[model samples]
Target: MARPKDDDPDMFRIIVATDIHLGYMEKDPARGNDSLVSFEEILEIASKNNADFVLLGGDLFHENKPSRRTLHGCMALLRKYCMGDKPIQYEFLSDQSVNFDHCQFPTLNYDDPNLNISMPVLSIHGNHDDPTGQGNLCSLDILHTAGLVNYFGKTSNLEKIQLSPLLFQKGTTKVCLYGLGSVRDERLHRMFVHKNVTMLRPKENQEDWFNMFVVHQNRSKHSATNYIPEQFLDDFLDLIIWGHEHECRIDPEWNGIQNFYVSQPGSSVATSLSEGETVKKHIGLLQIKGKDFMMKKIPLETVRPFYMEDIVLGETSLNPDDHNVLKKVEAFCTEKVETLLDKAAMEHTGNRKQPTKALIRLRIDYTGFEPFSIHRFGQKFVDRVANPKDLVLFHRRKAGVKKEESGADNELLAKIRPQSLDSARVEDMVRDYFGQVEETSKLQLLTEKGMGDAVKEYVDKEEREAISELVKYQLQKTQDHLKVRNASEDRIDKEVTHYREERKKRKEEDEEVAEALKRAHSMRSQSEDHPCDDDRMSLDSDEESRTTRGRGRGRGSRSRGAKETTRGRGSRGGRGSRGGRGQMKEPVIATNGNRSILDAFASSSSSASQRSARGGNKRKTYSGMDMSDDDDVVTIDDEDPFDISSSSRKQKSQRKTTSRRGVAFDSDSDDDIIPLPKRRR
Candidate 1:
C-alpha cells in the first residue's frame, strides 16, 4: 500500500460509533431516559467535530420493533441535525450504480435544496433489529424511507448474503465501504465457507482505493467460540470496524500490518451489568488518508457511573444476627457509596450538575448464612444512603476457604497414600478430598445438631412402628367398606330382577284378557255370518260338553263367561248335591318366589293331579295359598319371605377385623380414648 500523493484531495474524517441501544431503557422507568440521552450526546459530539458523515456499526436500536416513543425520539433527533441542511454530495469513483434491492428510497427529491440531508447516518441492522418474520422488513427500513438514514448490508434474497459496497470519492480518496450485517453464529460459519459468498472488493487496478469492511461479529483473541478469526480477513480488508463487544478497543497496525487497523467504539451505553460493562465507554473518530487511518478515542459522558465492589467476610458460618458483622458490612457499603459520590462531584461541571445516581453492585463472600437473609445488611446501607437508585447485593461462599479436618475425613484421607505427586495424582487427591468433604457435610446434617433431629428426636422407633400399623389398619378398613358397598349394589340388582319378573307376569295377564275378548268377538262374527242350522248345531254340542264337565267339577255357580281352563281334575266321582256342595270355584293363579307365573301354574296342576288320583276330597296348599272345596274360603299369607335387613346385619358382623399392632385398645372397656404424647413446642 502506498501513501496518497500531496496533490490529491483533503483527508476523509468520519465519526464511527456503534451499539446505541435506543430502546434499552424501556423496562426501568427510572432509567428509561438513559439510552436516548447517551445517543444524543454522541450525535452532539459528531456535529461538533464537523464530521463528514456518521457511521453506525450495528445495533442502533435495541429491539426489532422499538416503541412508538422511542422511534419518535430517535427520528426527531436524527432529523434535527441531518435533515434540511447542506445535503452531502459524493462523486462516483466506481462504475457500479447505487443499488436499492433490499433497502428503502428517500421520500423527497434528493437534489432539492429544501429536502437536503446534511450529515447522513449510515448503518446496518444488528441481531436485535434484524427481520423477525417472513416479511423481511426491519425498524431501520422506516428511517431509510423517511430520508433520515442510509441502511446498507442487506440482500433482496434471504437465501444468500452478499456484501454491497458504497463506492464514493471523498476529495481524492477512493473509498469502498462494504458492510455485512449480523448473522447467527451457525449461519455465519456456513456463509463464510459458502462457495458463492464473497466480499465486495475493488476491481483490478482500483485496488488503490481504501477498502474498509464493516461487520457486527464476535471477535475474540483467545476463544474461537462464535468468533470470526482475524486471520481470515487479513488479505481482503484494509480497515475493519468491529461491533457487538461492550469494551472499547483500538488495534492500530493490526496483525502487524503497518497500514491495517481494527477499531471498536463499543457500546455507547451499558445494556447489562456485566464485568465488561463497567469499563469506560468511548466513540471513535476515524481520519483516513490513502492506506493509513488515525483513530481517536472520545470518552462518552452520558453513560451512568457504575461501581462494583467485592468484600471478603474472611470466615465461614457467619451469623446473620451478629450485630458486629452487620455493622462492618454496613460501613463498607457506606464507604463505597461516599467514594463514588465524591468522584462524581469532582467530574461534575457545566450543565451536568445534577447529583450523580450510581449503580453500586456489592458482592459479599460469606458462608453458613442464607443468601436471602444477607440482604438485611444491604437494606440497612440502602436506608442510610441518599441518591442510591439501584443496589445489587450478591452473596457467595468464599472461593478458597480452608475446611477443618474432622476425624472421619482424616481417617478417609489417611487411607490414600502414593509415592509421588504428578498432575494425575494431584487431580485424584483433590477429587477424593472434595468427595470426603461433601460426605462429611451430609453426615453432619443427619445428627442431633442438624435439622433432621427436629423430627427424629420426638418420634421414637416404637411410635413410628405404631404409626405404620395404624396406617395399615385404616387401609384395611377402607377396603372392607368398599366390599360392603359392593354387596349392597348386588342386593339392589336382585331386587331389580324381582321387579322385572313381576312386570312380565302383569304383561302376560293383559295378553290373556286381550285374547279372550278377541275370541268372543270372532264367535259373535261367526254366528252372525253363518245362519245354517247344521253349523249352529255343531257349536251347541261343543258348548254342552264343556258345561257338563264344569258342572261335574261342582262349578255350578261359576260364571258362563268361560274361565281359564284348569289342567288338573278333582278327586270327586260326580258333582255333589247342591245342599252338600259349596259354591262353584274358579282356580286362582299362585306364584312361588322368583318363579314365573306359568311355571307356578304348571307345578300346581301336577300336584293336584296326584291328589285327584288318590280320590280324596282334601284341601291343598301351594306357595302360602289355601285351596279348598268352599269357593269363599281363600287364604293367602301377605308377609314378605326375604328378611333383607337381618341378612345385611349378619354379613357386616361376620366381616373380620384387622389384627391390632403395638398396644391394643379395648373399646368395650371403660376407657375408649387412648392418650397421645404431647408435642414439644
Candidate 2:
C-alpha cells in the first residue's frame, strides 16, 4: 500500500518482526507448544500500540504442513491487530467466547478491500523455511491463498497488488511494503540474480516516505546463500528487519546513519529446539512523531514472563523414602508456585523462568517429573494463569547422556546444560556444527601431508629419492655444524669457568694484600713514633733512659744494633729479589715445582686412555673438532705436543743430537716415548 497523504506530510508508523518460525513444534504434541506465542504476542502489541502496518521478516513457518490450529491461530491474531476497520463479525461473538480453531484446509476466498483491520500482512521465508533444506517449498502459496497473509516469495515480485500505491488515501502517508517471503538457499547457483529489495517508496518520492523493508536472511553470511560476495544490502533502504536466528538483538551499526534497524524477534514463542538457545524475546515499537522515528524494544518477558527453576525430585519409586522425597519436592514447588501466583495476573502470566518485565513470552520447564500428576499440579499451581487456556503441560522424556563405544559418557556431556535437552532444534544445530567442523578438517587435511592414511604410498619414487637426498644432505650439514658448535661451546664454557675462578682467586689475593698493607702501615707508624725514644716509653712506664745526641753508650747503642739488623734485612730482601730471576728456569726451584711437573707427566700418562680409545674405534674425522664422542683428550705434557712450534722444533733437534750422542732418557723399565716440551716446565 504505497499511497502517501498530502495532509500529513512528515511521518509514518510501522512495526517490524522477524524470523517467526511458525508451526515449529507442532509435532511436539506432548509439549503442546504448537501456538506461535511470540508472533501472536507481537500481533497483539502491534495492534494495541496502533502501528500503521506490521512486517513479518521471514520464516513464516518451519514446514509446508503447518497445522490448521497454527493457521487459525495466525489468522485470528492477525485479524485482530492487522486491521484498522475490520468487520465486527470477525471479532469474537461474545465476551465469554470459545477459543476458535481452524478446520483442516480452511477455505479463504474472502479477501476484500473494504475491511477495517485488513491491512496488508507482509512476510518472508527464513533459512529453516526455505527449500533445499528441511524446509517447506509451498508455505507461501498456502498462506497467501488462505487470505491470511500477503507475502513475496518470488524471484520477480509476484504480488504487485499489495505493493501498489492504490491502497492508501491522497493525504495519508503511504508505505510500499515489499517482502522476500522466502530467504535464499545455498544449494542453488545464483547466476548473480539480485536479492529482494523492498522499498517504502512514497507516492512520487515524497520527502516524508519511509521504507520498512522486511527480510529473512542472516545479518551475516548464513547457509541461505552460497555466493562468495554476499548480496550487499545497499540500496534505497531505510530500515531492514531480519529473521532466522532466535535471539532478540538490534544492530545499530548498520549504514552508519543509525536510521537502519534490524531485529530477529527471537522466536514467536518461548520454546525452541535450537542449541545454545537463549530466549531474549524482543519486538520493535516505532513511534512516528514527525519523520524522526524512535524505536524501543519490547521484550516479551515484561508482561507475560517466563520462569524455569530447578526442581529436584528424589527417587520416584513407590518406596516410603521415595514418597517422602517426592513430598518434599512437591512442598517446595507448592511454595514457589504460591509466590509466583502472588505476582501473576490475568494478562501477565508467570512461567517457569519468570519474565517479570519484558514482553509476554511464557516458558515453563517441568523437569524431573516422577510418576505424579503434573497436570494436577499445573491446574492447582497458580492463580490467573490463563488457566487451561494459557497453561500448558510438558512431559520431558530425556535421553540420558549419550555414551561412547567404550561405554564411557562423552566428555562434552558434562558441559551440556540440562536446559538444552529440552529443545529439538539441537539436532539441526549439531548437524550444522559438525558440517562446519568437517569442512575445516577437510581443508586442513588437504594442506597438511600427515593427515592421510596412505600418505607414504602417495609419495612418488622420485619424491622419495629427493626426500632421502635432502635428509642425507641435511644430516651431513647438521653433523658438521654440531661438531663445530659443540667444540666452541665446550671450549667457551671451560674458559669462562676458568676465568671466573681466576677472578675469585685474584679478589682473595687482593683482599690479603690489603690486610697486609694495613698491618704494615700501622707497624711503621708505631715504630716511627718510638724510634730510639726510650724516654717516650719512660713517660708511660719506668724504662731505660734516652740518648738523643750521636748515640753514646746507652739505649741508643741497642737502637743502632736494631738499625744494623734492619739493614741486614734490606740486604737479604735484595738477594732474594736477585734469586727470583734464576729460579723459574731451574728444575729444582722447589719440591712443589718438581711435584707439579711430575703430576703433569702422570696426568699425561693417564690421558693416554683417550688415545687408546680413539685408536680402537674407526676414526670419524669430522670437519669440526667438536665431537660428542669425547675420546680425543687434550693432554699438556712436559714434552712438546705441538711439533710445529719453533721452540718445539728446536728442542726436537737438540733431542735428536743428544740421542745421536746416546744421551737417551734412561728410565728404569718406565721408559715411554714422549714428545719434546714446547716450553720449559
Candidate 3:
C-alpha cells in the first residue's frame, strides 16, 4: 500500500493499535515478555514517526488486574518513548471536562503542568479490562491516574449513552473523535435497537470536522445480538476504528450502507492459538487531512509465529488393527510437526530477535483408530514449541451426522473459539447458554438479559448477594403491580401463592433438566472415545431443549389456583374469622429504606403518581371518609411507627392519606379496620 504524503501542514498523524494484551502469559517462561516486547515496538514506532498521539482501541492489558511486573514494564516503555520536549502541533478543541469526566485531571496529559507528556496515549477499556468492584476502576484508570495515559470513553451510565467527541484541530483541519469504550454486547445491541445511544455532534462547524468514532465491540455476528450492526451508527461518520476482534485486518473497508470507512486494527499480540490469531499482526498509521484519511499498516516483527494444521489418520494408509499401528501413527504425526516447525522457521527468517519457539497445533482425526498418549507425544516437541502440551489434539468424527447439523456445529464452534481465549465475559457465557433455549421456555417474570446482567455482576464484582437482590427486586415489582390493580385481599393472596409455587416448581424442574443434560453430555463423551473434542461437542446435540423446560408447570399452577378459588368461594361462610372473600383491603406496601435496589422503581412510581394527579383522577373513600383529591398520599410508609409522638399522630390525622389505587383513609379511625390474615405456621 502507498503511504500518504506528509507535506500537508494541517494533516494529523496518529498511531492506532488495539488489544495489545500486555501481561498475557506473563508467568510462562517462554512467552512472558512477548506482549511487553511488541508493546515497546509499537511505542518506538510512534516516537520514530513523530505521531501526534497514540490511539488504542481497547484491551491494552490482557488481565483486568495486571501484575506488578506488567505495570512496571508498561510505565517504563511509555516514559522511555512517549516523554520528550517535542512541541505538540495539534490543539484540543473539545471541552476537557466532558471528554475526561472519569479522570481527576480532566485534561490532556500534556496539558497538565505537573506531567511532561510528549506523546498522548488515548484509549478506551475493553471487556478484558473493563471496570469492576465498588470503585468501578479498571487497570487503565490506574495508568490514567499516573498521567501515563489518557483514558476516555468510560461510560458511567448504560441506560442511555451520550457519546461526546474529543475534538482537535491542526492548522485549518478539524477532527471530532467519538468513542464508546466497551459495553456488554447484548446490552449495547439492545440499546442500539431501542435508539437509546446518542452521538453528540459538534455544535459549531458540523460539516467541516471529520467525524471519527472509536469503538471496542464484537464486529462480527457472534449471535443475534452479540455484535453491533454497522447500520446502528450514524451516517455522518467519516471513519470508524473497530476493536475487540483479534484478527489483523488493518486495511480499511467501506460500508456502502452507512457510507463510512471502517479500519479494524486487530490485536497486536496473539493471546490464543486459534486460526484467527495466526494472521500477521500489524498496527496502523492513520493520517487525516480534513475529511479524507489514509491507513498505513506497519507489520510487527516481534510477534511470535504460529502454525496450525489438521490431519486424518483414517484418510492415510494406516491400519488400526496392525501390530505396528501406534508406531506408524506416531511417525506420521512427527512428520507433520517437523513440517510445521520448518514453516515457522521460514516465516521467522528475517526477524532474528523474535522468539525461537513457535506455537503449533495439530488436530488429528483418529476415527477407526486407537489414539496414542498426547502427553507422551508432546514430550518430543517440548524443546521445539512454545506450547507443547496443547500442540496435538485428537478427535473422532461421529457417524451418520447430517451436513446441515455438522455445519451448524462448526459455525457455533467458530464463534466460540476466538472469544474463549480471553475476551469472553461472564455475561457472554450466560447469554450463550440461554441462547440455546427456546424463547417461550425462558423465564417469564425475569428477562434473559436481566439474569445475564445479574450473573455478570456477581462474577465480575464478586458480589455474593447480587443474584438474590435481583430476585427480590423482581418479586417486589410483581407484588406492587398486583396492588396497583386494586385486587381483593383473597385475590392478592392467591396470586402471590401461585407465583411462589410456580417459582419453586420451575426451580426444581430446571435443576432436574440441568442434571439430565450433564449426565447425557457425560455419557456422550464416554461413548465418543475422544476426550479432546469434549468442549467443542458439548452443545452439539439437544441444542433447542438444552436449558429448557416444559410449560406444564405454569398450566398446572393456573388450573390448581382456579380450583382453590372455587372451593374457597363455597366455604366462605365456614371461615368467619377471615374477612369476606371479596373484601377490599388498603394497600400497605413495605419499603426498605436501607437498600438502593428499589430506588429506580420508587422514582418511576413517583413519576406515575404525578402523572395520575395531572390526569384529574377523583379520590375514593377507604373507610367511609371523603378526602380531597389534593391530599398527600404515602403508599410506601418508611417512617418509624413505634417512635411516633402524639403530636405526630395528630399531624398525620390532619392530612388525608390515600393508597396507591386511590383509596383514601382516616388515620384516627379504627372501627372499619380489618385485621390482616395471619401466617399458617
Candidate 4:
C-alpha cells in the first residue's frame, strides 16, 4: 500500500488550501460565481501539480448549510478532479482499532473498490460550517456520505476520547493525518485546559510514521492566543497546516519547536477586497520527505481584478457643476480601470487565465464638490469602463475633506493644548486641596458637639453647625456600640426562660401521651394471651351499642377494663406472656365496608385527645413492638388488599373502643401491623 521509495522521492506531495468560501458572492450576481470559479482553478492546479492529496483548512462553504445551488456546484467541481479512473482501493492502517458507526453520514463507498476517489479531499468544518447541533450533519457530511471527500475530527462517539486519524503510506513514511475542526474561542480555551482535552497520541509505530496536524482556526500574530499555541502542538505534530486565517504564510520551522513546519495557504479567492486580501491569492504546494519538507506558494489566477482609484483634488476650488472638474474625475476612473485590465491580461498570458471583468472603487475627495454631483460624475465614467455590467463602484470622502467636515483638527488641538494647565497653577491648586483635607483630618471642631458659638468666632455659623452635626453622629454611633455590648446578658436570660418553660410543658405532655399508649398496648397483649373469639365479638357489640347511645365509654368502664387486663396478665405471669401469646387466636377479619366506618370513629376520638393536650391533631402509627425488619417478613404484592395506614388505624381503634366498653379487646391484627418509622442511624 506504499508508494515506492526506490529513488528517494518526496515522502508526500500535499496541496494545502483553505477558506474557499463558496457562495461568498451570492449578493453580487455578476461576480458572485467568482469564488466558485477560483475554487475550480485551485482544483485544476492540484491536478496539474499531481498533488498526492488535498487538505482543506475550513470554511469550505460560506454558510453552515449552503444553498442547493451552491452545494451542487461545489460537488460537480470536486467530482471532476477527484473521481478517479477506478474505485478507491485503500485500507486504513488503524481500521481494526477504530469504528465509523457513529458517523451520521458514513460513506458507503469508503472501501468500495468499484468507486474511485483520487487525491481524496480531507477537510475539517470551519466556523461558517461548524454549526451548533449538527456535529455530524453539516454540508461536509453530505459530500462525505457521497464518497466525494474524507471528513475527520468529529467526536460524536461516546466510546472514543480522541479522534482517530486518517492513515496513509507513501514509501518509507507512513502518514498519520489528524484534524480538529474549528471551535469557538471560549470553547477551544476549555479544550486547551490541562487534562481537559484528550489529544491524539502516537501508537506503537510512532518512530516509523510522520504526523501532520490540520486545523481550521484563527492564527493571526496579534491574537495568536486565540489559537492553539504552536509550541504546544509541536509535542506531537511534525507539520501543522492551519486554515481560517485568510492570509498565506509559512514558517519553515517554528522557532520554538524544532523540525516542525507550519503553513497557512490563505484563501483561493478574495472574499473581501480588503488591503490584506488585495495581495496575490495563493495555495501551498508541500513536498515532504522523512523529516524534511519544502513549501512553495503557488499564485491563483482566477481572481477578478480589483481597481481602487483615489482621486485627490488640488486647491483649485473645483465646483461640482464645472464640466472640467467632472471630466477630471471621469478620466481618473477610466485610466485606473484600463491599467488593471492590462495587468490582469499580462498575468493570465500563460496557462492560468484571469477573469476579464474588473471591480472599480472610486474615492472622490474635494472641498467644493457635492457628494451627489460627484457620484453622478463617477457613474458616468464607470459606465464607459470595458465591462460596465461587471464594474462595482465605491465612493468615499478624502482625508482632508473628512477632517474639515468633522473639525477633528480643532478637537485634536484642544486635547493636546499645553496652555490649559500651567505647572505652577496646578501645583498650587493641588496643594490647597490637600491642605483642606489635612486640616479636616486633624480638626478639633469636629469633636465638639456644641461648638456653634466657639467656632462662629473663626468661621461661619453654617460651618459650626456642620462640625456639630459630625460630632453628634460620632457620639450616637459610640452609644449604639455600648448598648449592643450591654444587652448580651439580658438577651441570654430571656432565651433561657423561654426554653425552660417550653421544656416543662413538653415533658408533662409526653408523660400523658406515654400513659395513654401504655394502656392501649397492655390491653392488646392481654387479649392476645387469652384467645376468646366470643369475648372479642361481645366487646365490639358493647362499644357499638354505647357509641350509638351518644354516650362514650364511662370513666368507670375504662378503669374496670384496665384492672381486668392487669389481672389476666398476673394470672398467666411469664408463662402467659411468652408461650400463651405465641399461640393466640387470629382476629376476626373486617371487610372494607365495616373497617371504614370503625376507622373513622377511631381517628376522630384519637385526634380529639391529641388536639386538647398538644394543641395539634398529630396522628402517629404506633407499633407496640420494635419490628425493624418486619418488611422482610410481610410480602406486599401489587394485588395486596391491605393498606398499612387504614389497617393500622382500624386495629388501634378497635382495641381502644373495646377497652373503653369495660371489656378485653385483644386481636392478632397487631402481629401483622406495619413497622414504625426507623430512627436515624
Residue ranges of candidate 2 with Cα displaced over 4 Å: 1-10, 27-38, 80-117, 128-137, 156-176, 185-208, 220-231, 250-253, 257-259, 271-279, 288-291, 301-681
Model 1 misplaced stretches (Cα beyond 4 Å): 1-9, 87-89, 92-98, 106-114, 156-159, 221-225, 250-253, 257-259, 315-323, 349-355, 367-390, 395-681
By TM-score, rank the candidates, best first.
3, 1, 4, 2
Alpha carbon lDDT of residue 666, candidate 1? 28
Q: What lDDT does model 4 reach? A: 0.54
The Cα local distance difference test for each model comes to 0.56, 0.41, 0.72, 0.54
Which wins on lDDT, candidate 1 or candidate 2?
A: 1
The TM-score of predicted model 1 comes to: 0.53
TM-score of 4: 0.51
Model 1: per-residue Cα lDDT at residue 607: 43
RMSD of each: 32.3, 37.3, 20.2, 26.1
The backbone clash count of each candidate, in order, is: 0, 43, 0, 2
- Please provide, for model 4 over 1-681, each residue's C-alpha lDDT reduced to its tens digit, 9 standing for 90 to 100: 123332354357778888989987666655678778888988988888777778898889987668888899999999898887643333356562252444554543446565676767878888777633213367877787777877767554222247567777665667777887876443454356543555555567687677788888656433434456665554666778888777556434464545566787777766654444545678887766675566777877777665555565543345567767656655655666667666656655254456665555544455455333434444554533333542434444545544343578678877761211101222234335445676445333122212322232113111222333334543454345446656465575454444434434443322222233334344445555666544444344334333222112222111333211111211122321311111112223333322333342233232234334434434321122122322111111111229887666555645543433222234434444333332353
Error of 1 at 178 (Å): 0.9
- Worst ten in a row by lDDT for model 2: 542-551
lDDT tens digits, residues 401-423, model 3?
56556877888877773443445
Candidate 4, which segments miss by more than 4 Å at Cα? 1-10, 86-91, 96-102, 105-110, 133-136, 156-163, 193-195, 221-232, 250-253, 257-259, 307-334, 350-353, 362-378, 381-681
Q: List the candidate numbers ranked by lDDT, top first.
A: 3, 1, 4, 2
Better of 1 and 4 by TM-score: 1
- Candidate 2 matches the true fold with a TM-score of 0.38
